[model samples]
Target: MEASKVIHAIYTDDDVLMSAVKTVKAEKYHIEDVFTPFPVHGLDKAMGLAPTRLAITAFLYGAVGLAVATVMMNYIMIQDWPQDIGGKPSFSFLENMPAFVPIMFELTVFFSAHLMVITFYMRSKIWPFKKAENPDPRTTDDHFLMEIAVHNNEESLTNLLKDTGAVEINIVNKDEDAH
Candidate 1:
């Protein structure tokens, strides 16, 4: 990979980071990434990132789970072994649906939550034993870090970050950091 210089701006407060993101974006500077201790509302919008489709995927997964539960219940209760419980031998799925509601709901929630987590991990390249991509360890605690590439405008970008309430700014040499 080609070496590139980047500026890392650290912010103590989320609000400061938010405003700094907007200001830097308004100046036509491309922000490569941002790391925060907690998720900042609307940070993706400020960074001009595309809206996530994870919700849609979750819904789809939930639907699949519901369907699986329905089919499984039908096969178990109505088709495979219809038991004469409480003297009611009705082998209809609809008739036994009330008993299946809890299962359906549980499976739906389970699939949505578990599958969404897996999808998020896969999409984010997060896997077992994977190294963290966070540039600054402080960002995992009480700081926010914004990384912007330097395109022969380090001085102007540094000055802008200072004006935008950056607590500290560091110029990172990507090649040196790789080692």
Candidate 2:
């Protein structure tokens, strides 16, 4: 409730870990999280993680950027800063829009890129000026870990994990030193 509550069981082999994940999922045991050094094929299906919608978000953000750029450019160059130096009509959207394209494209790319990066950081809880909380360093390198929080009893959970080919298991107290 107050902090991250998890117990990590590390596995050396990806094949063993994937099979264990499939078994736990089949048994309806809720896995808190799984970390792997490299991507494991079909692991997302086994973990029941739905496909991400980042592409949709990117498209929507890009559209918003485009609209904003178009509106701003139309108002500014057509109304406020009309230039008559090129011997062309000052307020013609069709004529001067070719000249306004660089600004529009720059604004679109800027807005979409900034917004998408912000969205990704917020969703993943990774941002500048914030420290990351990675449990096992080996899991970031060459190991895979599966975590489950056992509420009242742990005997059956431990038995199940052991039977599923967990190479090493340990209880991790997340709040012991975290402030």
Candidate 3:
């Protein structure tokens, strides 16, 4: 099985962390992980992460929700159980569409919010009662963490980590557990 070796370094400030990230990329070292308490702008560029596609998914889901709402309302209110809700006309779907607009709009909003939330949760691999993979509690609170796996130069890597202003460092034998 393939294994991942990690060096976890904690930094006190974001500036130091960003500088270290740039320096590491310049040196051609692969950075495996970074955890920050809050988002630091330009961090994704420094780490070379691709732009997320969640917004596109959200828009598609919204359109699906709107379409479902419009179709269901038309079938139920206009065809299945026709009612003389207003005195305009009874048998015409187009004539009665204005009255169903409120319901369609409401269902659109409802489905969009509910389905989008579920999609986000599933796409992110977050689920109810799932255990978190927080390695250190302080990583969520204040400290910024950088995890790098080196193929060689353990001594030089340690020296480079110190030069990057890492306050604490530890070797972590990351488990290669199957997802």
Q: Best candidate, lDDT-wise?
A: 1
The positional error of residue 179 in candidate 3, measured at the CA in angstroms, is 12
Error of 2 at 48 (Å): 1.1
Worst 10-residue lDDT window for candidate 1 reads 87-96
For model 1, how does the per-residue alpha-carbon lDDT over 1-179 read when each residue is reduced to its tens digit?
77899999999999999999999999999999999999999999999999999999999999999999999989988999999899877499888889889999999999999999999999999999999989989889999999999989999999999999998999999788677
User: What's the distance in Å from true for residue 84, model 2?
Assistant: 2.0
Please give the lDDT score for candidate 2. Answer: 0.82
CA lDDT, candidate 1, residue 157: 96
lDDT scores for all predictions?
0.94, 0.82, 0.82
TM-score of each: 0.88, 0.86, 0.88
What is the per-residue lDDT of model 3 for residues 89-172, given as tens digits with 9 covering 90 to 100?
A: 557768777877887777777777787788889977799898877667787888999989956667788889999999998877
User: Any runs in candidate 2 off by more than 4 Å, and if so which?
Assistant: 1-5, 174-178
